[model samples]
Target: MDLRQLRYFVAVAETRHFGRAAERLHMAQSPLSQAIRQLESQVGATLFERTTRRVDLTPAGTSLLEDARRILAGVEDARRRVEQVAAGTEGVVTVGATDLAAYRLLPRLA
Candidate 1:
């Protein structure tokens, strides 16, 4: 439903074990499991088929996995772009120079 929950879902989906997913996320297992449950409830579908040994994605989970990954990647890209702008490292730079000056100077700058 949210980024955090989606992240949690991806972790569990990738690892196929709640404990391992929790370890990968550096959180306690209980909260990770709760988050996955909450995510499933919010989505109105059972996302994972869980057994004592491992977890497997249901059809709905498989469908969401791809979208969740794309959404997270987009969020990260936006965050990076925002940081670049904040740091004055983003956008275009235009320089004006005479033809000869550009021929002489641009190579050295490059």
Candidate 2:
């Protein structure tokens, strides 16, 4: 439902084991499992088929996996763009100069 839940879902989905996903996420397994439960509730679908030793995505989860990946990727891209702009490493700049200044100074500056 939210970004945190999506992240948690992605982690669990990718690893296919709650314990391993928790380790990969650097969190305790309990909370990770809880978050996934919450995500399943919010989404109104069962996302995984769990056995004693392994986890597998259900059809709904398979559908969600693609969108979750895309959404996370877009969020990451947006975050990077915002950070870059804030750090003055990206975005547009406008300069005003006379023709002679543009011809000479801009060339030298570039």
Best by lDDT: 2
The per-prediction CA RMSD against the true structure, in angstroms, equals 3.5, 1.9
User: What's the lDDT for residue 63 in model 2?
Assistant: 98
TM-score of each: 0.82, 0.87
lDDT of 1 at 100: 93
lDDT agreement of model 1 with the native: 0.94
Candidates' C-alpha lDDT: 0.94, 0.95
- Report model 2's TM-score to 2 decimal places: 0.87
Candidate 1 lDDT by residue in tens digits, 1-110: 89999999999999999999999999999999999999999999999999888799999999999999999999999999999988989977888889998899888988
- Candidate 1 regions off by >4 Å? 92-110
